[model samples]
Target chain A: MRKINSRQAGKKVPDYLENNIVRFVYLLRSEGVRIGNSEVIDALQALQYVSLENREKVKTALKATLVKKAADAVIFERCFSFFFTPPETRERLRELRQQKIARHEHQIKEAEQVFTFRGEKMNLSALDKTVYAYMPETEKKRLRDFLEMNESRETLQQWYRPFLETLVKGRLRFWHKQLHKEIQEVIAQRDTGDEELNAIRDAAAGSGYGGRTILTEDMQHITRKELPQAAALIRRMARLLATRISRRYRYSKKRRLPDLRATLRASVQFGGVPFKLKYKSCRIKKPRLLLLCDVSGSMIRYSSFVLQFIYSLNAVVQRIESFVFAENLERVTPYFQQGQDFERTMTAVVRESGQWGGGTSLHSALKALMMRYGDELTGNTTVIIVSDTRTIHHREAALELEKLREKVKEIIWLNTLPRQEWSSYTTVAAFQRSAAMFPCNTLADLEQVLSRKFLSA
Target chain B: MFVSLEKLQKGFTSAGYICDEEVILTVYLALRLEKPLLIEGPPGVGKTEMGKALARIFHTELIRLQCYEGLDENKALYEWNYQKQLLQIQAGRVEGRYGRVDGDLFSREYLLERPLLKAIQADRKVVLLVDEVDKSDSEFEAFLFEVLSDFQVSIPELGTIRARHIPIVVLTSNSERELSDGLKRRCVFLYLDFPGIEREIEIIKARVPQAGERLTAEIARAVHHIRQNQEIRKKPSIAETLDWARTLVSLNMDRLQGSTIERTLNILLKSRGDQRVFREQIGADALEKKIRSSLV
Candidate 1:
């Protein structure tokens, strides 16, 4: 084994080794591993005890000190291997590192030019510097005077009233959009060769431009061929939703109530009078879920996604009954009840129903569904209708939905159509009168509904 | 504390624990950085045993806090000595110094230290093992942020108690429940799966020295073969492999026959379902096949 005392009393290690450690930590931080300032110092000290000759030990020394999660450890291992190449490959890495530093210095200069606010002359706080980037020239002057004026500064220092007045009336959203657009323009002007900046741009593409959640934008339109990736995402969402719902139910169960009979029984041991309290605990039953999906020709893509999403949740939810409808209603719950493979079961259900590529007529389907399963709906059941109400040449069926809503605990409508398209559809406004409606035109919308409505409800 | 990774590997071998390069490096970094190493893996992978071995290797006190459902800060951290506080109050009243007893009940004299508090208050370094931390509630996991990052405990009355010597914290999890991201951010993650055939043989030799070389090798090979069947619910870990070797040596069996396998099968397989699956998958002929290939 090669032995070297890099920490020999007041002597430092070679400059190359020190730079290697710092660069490794920098690469880790950029890859989203949370490495604090103290963690860096601890890693440097840890290197003194590890053998640099053996690559495994040296890499482990960095990982065990730097990474905090098992997921992050995978990223750390990949980066450490790339950074700590053989001596022959070191020159290429050094050249890349130098190029990266030069690019970073250029980005820093651009940021300094962009963020150099005139509010510094008025002795404004650092918050004014950030707000100045989004403000027009006229507003910048107004804000400057507001900061310099004694009375306005006193009001701003109050923190509560000033904050409410400043952010109220949707001003925060306007400023946020302005700042996002300004920053995007600045970033787009830079060299696209930067991999790190490209990663950020790719991430921003999914969240929409200017960080705006446009209701008219159908962000994720599922297709038949893309079912595998959607299925995986649904399975992960199922696990999280299941844990959250069960944890909440378990928490309520643990808070026991004082039972009179139990307290009286325990009092007999203490001379007919109770000094200590005894409680009775009961388990809260999980709410049953009933899904009615519209599988018409207009809603084929959305129906498949909603069905897959609900079936994947069968692992967490004990009681789930699913039905698909176009002109007629057919219960597909038995397929899921068989515990078969997900894709096979879904394919079997789709073929057996034979409702694929059908015309829209929710009126007849709802009437048939109620006539067949009237006794199944109860106050313990949550009825969810995943559909787009294009009614076509059928009745509105608003009164039937109202009657069905009274039988169930709650009726949640996950409208696959965009919010802007709802007003154009004749039957959607009437249907919304009976059920609590939420937009489900995108994957982000579906995730939000699952977390907020299903888990919390 | 180790000269090299190989030296650490040898040190663990002498300590009767055969570890690979990853484990040795993780433990050495844990010692050098003084950060908590959170070990996660499947059940029966010797995750908890690593904590015990590290404590032994460093010759530090091992403070184990076994976590379960509804584990709270008061249970894992510190609690007040109610009876001692009452006694002190009575003494203060009898001595006519009732006014002086204010805030005295919350002092160190009336504090009963739990595993966390004891670890921080320890004069020397310690190996604090929070075993099966995933079994605990999310709130308790959140409460560990202070003790983990700053090595201190905060009480409203007693103020903060900092560590005199930073303990070597090792948290073990079987991944029964997902831990919070906040707690995961303050720890170094290490995952240990079941040992391979060669590592299993080394572990068997070190843990069960009384067993013959041929018998140990045969047991390791058979176990390696058995673990290949994914249908088996609980694969035999290193501890189970050692137990199997020791059982064979004590019974004076040189070969692994059907009767010997039948007699000591329970030592390796815990569940009846897993045993049934193993027996159905690997029958008499399969056992003979494993034994034949084990020699060469």
Candidate 2:
């Protein structure tokens, strides 16, 4: 790295500090923190105000200029320690990267080797070649012996090609399992003296799913220890949602029709000249949210997160109604409205309601909701149903959902199942007919769904 | 002007603001770079207090704009004194100077300067604190971009008005909303979390000197413990901590006993829900025991 030195506060600053700061900003951007050129420049300019002798001052100065959000601060801390602490660590990390690249290149070369059968080169698929290259020496010898024995069989000649392909595919699956296990073991053994550097490298390499940021991790796979971080991220997303909704309402409130009567009434003080115009100031109705969360065995994990999100939005939305259902629907809006802590409230709802960890009956749940809260459904209401779409009596449930859809402005189905698995579930197809379905198995998906559905409206 | 970072830290300390190195460094850079400092954190983390402290340290005026829903440019930037203009027009008709009043209607004489305009048009450097800026509409936030970037505002009648002496700008938010990327990019960002245990004790001692040293330490530890509880929705703020300390001093309590804590817990935990959680989950006796154990 080229070094540039500058004078600030009558002190000579180190040349490498600027170069390191620029690299650190890029590191932050790669870790999903947004930074622009101006911020980079600001970070550079901030260096002039602090003495480089003090490490904490330098870190703080860079942080003030480069980081904008609180959630990104944790990533910044990790990256800062990894990049700036113990100058030799950076060199060590560079060496590790080089070694990793060399290893990958060697593996690719080995995978390019062709298989031979009876002095003739056999054309193999890419999967077979990869599996052959990475497989253990013993497994390779076993495969060779098996193939050699089968090569001279005249009775099985007609069915040879299909059989060979199936055998290679089975080996490919086993190879994948082996590779995954090795990677997990490598991650588990933190041999690196610098744990922060190892963690950053692991996350960058995408080896350990647990090493990934909480925002991008799947909700169901989030461990108990990571729940607090996940909950904080959810709360931040909810806060952003509330702000967008309030801003939209405030903007629309300003564009109302002019109130000529009020204008005249005000002009009476000014000789009836109608000097100023008055707006009608009609009350803008906040969008009503009705959340129906399925607490069945399959969807219990996602429902708790969704309920926590709704609980965070309790103060912002005036007419939010929450319902959790398994075999039957139970209204839990009162629990949220009580202003108690979410943990206690969630515990009470789970214990008192008869819908905890049971089979899903969407038809009965929707029927019970309509019969009890039919008057609350209106054009302003948005019905959000969080579920896996796996329920008994799918046909009746679809019909009831369509009926509920007709009474509300829109029905948004947050399917807990991944998008690739949606096709395998017939219930997903049926539910898709009456509601706009979005796969929301992760916090990122939930944020995107909420922003697209609610903010756009 | 502060020639060194140590001087700035001392200035802030003298101003009665207990800030860490991060705060001092960020504020120093903001001052040197002439960039707006956007401070965001949870409620009552001294985001607004930092701005006030800056103004006090500099011996300048602190012009505040308390942002809320539907805040507009006219209210924040500047507004025309319409009634004065109308009176002028009526007087001009009587005096046969209608054309003169028409020219004077949009002049500086009738222009009412709000916080933004006042900060720009001040004869000396001032501190501008836009408090709870996240509460304002996005349009208002967008409107701020122009004034903040160039330190100037354009009025149709008076044309562009630039700053006489560029005032130091500090914007505070409670993280109620995410600010625009454009706005965030234009300023330096700082996040103020709750003070740590030692810092809280120092703050209590500074703000409420009547309280005994033992009492202050116990109060700080108890408050820290409560803040660590995830169940409490609204954590006790520094101001609340000081208030609790003062209450302890006035009540002549030297140490935090279980009964005294039970009686005075409401001072720190404002909401009934927070109070109930503190009682049921982390009871007064448990907290007292923890505090006493820490002391030993």
Candidate 3:
């Protein structure tokens, strides 16, 4: 057998080391890795089994005891390395912090110089920044704190959009609009020092200084890099949809009569007449979702977000079969099952399907899709088509869609086009006649549309 | 009981099990604190083997409970012997002695003990391995709280039967579904990934002793490389590495080469798809070259 390969091999651990381990466990917990008191006790006892000098052994031991899930192992490993940084690295980190402080002080001095410049023309007091500067720093800080408060409040309103208007105990929309108007007027009127301030604002926006940034009305404005957040929001919305739909369906229908076998078994003492009736609770057969996503050039921007949404929904409800189409269709149901990262899964999907780069041919795509996977759809299936419906020069595949609608419970089309522009797109109007069309131009649209159509019904 | 974790590690090593610090530490803590150790890993990573090894170290009987879908408390815990109860009831009625014995029939004499109950009621401490617990439903997972947390089982008829000896519980899961937070909160969670190359070599030499050192190293290295290839479905595990080494020794190969690997590829790769993927992607020559480079 190999002997313990560390300088402190067979050495007893001191009491302070256990305290350090406990603190490390709490650090892991604060980083959103779930760890319990049992794990802390285990870690303290487990340190006896391994040499502290042996970094790899200590890491593996802590990981085994602390991390429960594979996804959490990533977080654990990252925090582990940071927590156990080497002595030299600690010194280097101190030096880096000093340098960062110096740089921050220099940048602040430059910012103060620019702001203090009294521009002779174009009165700058109308601007929000000049007005904020006149107030105490505490007042400005409160404004920032209030903005932080509104961010979470805005997220809550995103979930309950319809009810937010009536519940007006704490509404800050008027104040937000006033500040935004002042900022806009400042930008509109050019002053002597305004260029430097505008440059500073551009830099802040580029680096994402959250406190100073103005909130846009469109809550669904997500960049390509924000796919992960968008995906999480979609998952939350999917769960909300599932619960709402199930609860509504459960209450709307009548329960079946008391189960005879159960009643007889329970009523054996009472000569078969049931004393406490066991009603046959209706088992809600979850509707199977079959998604047909358009992946042409026009719909490529919205397709990924839609696919992530569908994938998260599939996670909650397992009865979803997804297919992607451009000129032809390919079943992407198996890709989501792999549980790989969204980017990697999408890359694989793109590589496998020949029609990923082709034009949108709705007639041919739907015909081929029905020819292949039409048998998979039952009366309990909900066929969801996620596309802009901008088919180029092809006739509205109404016959195939009508046939599909006949086979499934309902055919719902998620149009990526804006509501005003939907009239300009002739193909979408034609398809809307065959199926129910809902505008899904953004992430918020998806939540509203899903709630209005499925849950409300 | 073992004096320390080092002693436990030594005992396992002497028993022909190559355990890393993680396994040794977790086993030690579980024994010391009397908490159930929840071990999760990909299949065939010696999760079940670790439980058995710990049992040997403790010198206790290993009671295994394999979990599957729809597994309930009836199968896991004690169940009543309905036939005996019914017969006794019939005899009581014949003798006209059944005035109001409402709860007398539901006694310990009519209880049929399963693995879980047997472990709890064992005379001495035993190793209770709840293997592949993720296969069981969430309701059954919640049902385990009474036994897992307090070392007692509640029967509506008998109130609660506490454990005679708190068995060293070892729960393993392949993470088929998310386990209940209540269950996780009670146990010390441990995740065992695949062993490193050197550790795997030690395991191979211990299990397949006839295989020479050179052949053992080569086989371990090949298995390590195969596992890194994400394209191959069903990566070759440590057990498969041992089997491949044994296969090579049985064929009387003094050293490993491209041809030897090609002939015994079936032992390493389980599926035809995996075999084809290995042949087309990472061929025998590539594996041999890696082994040679590592040896140098």
Candidate 4:
């Protein structure tokens, strides 16, 4: 155990320790852990009481003072271990970073030598060349064609040489889109050669954190080991959502008219002066939910997560009707009502439905649902459709959804496809026109959409 | 208050609360810094017990405020005894002494102190346990901000009631809902998970000394095995484990036999669904075999 001198009463914190704590706090904030000034001051003050001889005591003190949520605890542990390394280890890590930077510079130099335009040397900066090298073949070909088409001998002579470079760089920037800055950052970090430092930076930045947290990880990519943790998170989120919905009814109770009979009954103790007035107990109308999950091959992973989420809400939502669709719609509410293990329920649902992993037919499915369960889709019902919006006869499906929207309170489409790729699928745009569509490819996305949309509604 | 972490641990042990160094460290720091300790975990993880243990260690009163839906300031903090006030008003009018009625109505005599106010006005330090705070409404949670941070509560009639002695406050949550960032900021957070098998065996031996060593070890192992079943909705809590051990001891059982577990499983698993799953999925015979294997 490494020991440091404890701060005495009415004494200031050592400058080095104070700086480390501030840096650690900054790292935590960057990693999405919210820490306030009061917490920092408490941590410093707490350090005075605990013996510095015990490392665990110091760590526990800081963690208790700083970290509030259980979810942020993982990030705190990682950042703590990284921040509080021994001096010799930190020095070695610093040297390793310098060595990596040297290797990155060498690679950049080599790339610059081979980066030529039209058999003549192109005088582009190392950053520009690195970005150009990272582009795909198709984008590279497009860039070459654009240069060939735009750069005429006369124009090149009339304009400055730097103008052509600027023109090429602008096209490269446009091709990279939102990722242009991130790519530039990666290249910049390469020059620093600080792998551990970069890891900490990336972890703190919440982008490409080491083995991305299960919440932010793609639903389809969650491994067998992480499945239990993912399920727990989903259950926790469902309970939270249920609580929010329940709170609405609690608030609505206050708005109810006074109960005259109960007020009079209670006034017997006070000689009928009516000191304690009670509100009329309102019957809570639990929100009716209709879940339509697409269990086609393309959307099975996302559908499983959605089904699990809905199943977890069974205790809270009394009037939920679940349905699964592939080539046709099949009501699977019975499977959920059985209240068995979710995995077994899912297995039974897949076995009995006969539509699992088949092609999607949203138009036919919606029509079938309307024909069979038309009475169930009242104005109080909110229909949530989980799909990638990849279906046969997209326009007809969109029309059917619009019709369903008229009969229901709302239609929410949770599209499994990433939002960036939505433009590529005409079906997504078609369904989006009729319903409020949100990306549901990850737990974070699902959480954001559900909390924002459902809570507001 | 304890001067060192070791003494705090020993105090907790003597108080019959089995905990690790981390828990002791957190409690020590919270006591030293005079901050409210926010303990969150799954149900039956000894969160509320921590408060009770603290009270025992300090020889202070354990003032508990059980939070729930629609809980408000009138229930948690001070409230004017309206019936008494009305009677005073009526009597004053009858006696032609109305001038003194208004002043006396809102006085300390008419102020009914709830748990929050009671803790604040206590002559000596006490352990104020705000249990299941997540079950309370957001407005009530926000109202707790003033009491927890500055140890003071403001009444419209009475200006402000600062704590006579800063009570050691322990707030426990099952995480049914996410607490506000503002409430979390003013607290020292500690998460208490279920103890491991060895520690749990220690707990069983400590709490239920009537049970033999083999029986305690077998019960701990059996509970641990049952907890590993993800399909079991409600895992056996430590309290439930102790109850099961006590039940077995009362029944004059030395070991967890398959038949005994089937008969006494109700004590461990509360929900019918969980019991059914435990029987159908994690069979008693299988758990018995696993427990017996440890002996070999």
Which candidate number would show the highest lDDT if scored against the true structure? 4
Which portions of model 3 show Cα errors greater than 4 Å?
A1-23, A37-65, A84-95, A105-289, A298-320, A326-355, A358-457
Tens-digit lDDT string for candidate 1 (B177-274): 55766676567678888888788878877777788788777888888888876556578877788788888888998767777887789999998866
Query: What lDDT does candidate 1 reach at residue B154?
Result: 86
- TM-score of B chain for each model? 0.94, 0.98, 0.94, 0.97
lDDT by residue (B1-296, candidate 4, tens digit) is 54577778888999999988788889988998888999999898899999999999999999999999989897899777766776777787789986766666668988889999999999999999999999998889999976799999888777988999999999999988788889999999999988999999899989999999999999999999888876676788999999999999999999989999999999999998889889888899988998999767
- TM-score of every candidate: 0.60, 0.82, 0.63, 0.82
lDDT of 2 by residue, B228-259 (tens): 88667789999898888988888999999999
Task: Score residue A394 of candidate 1 by CA lDDT.
Answer: 39
lDDT of 3 by residue, B156-237 (tens): 8788778898988999987645576678777777778889988998898899989988888888888999897755657787
Which scores better on DockQ, 3 or 4? 4
Model 2, span A1-85: residue lDDT tens: 2233332234544557565676567667666789999999998888877677777877888899999988788777777666664
**Is 2 or 3 the stronger prediction by DockQ?**
2
Docking quality (DockQ) of candidate 3: 0.31
TM-score of chain A of each: 0.50, 0.65, 0.48, 0.68
Model 3 Cα lDDT, one tens digit per residue, A333-442: 89888866556777887787776657888788778877888777888777889888887644657667777778888888988776645765678767877798998776
Best by DockQ: 2
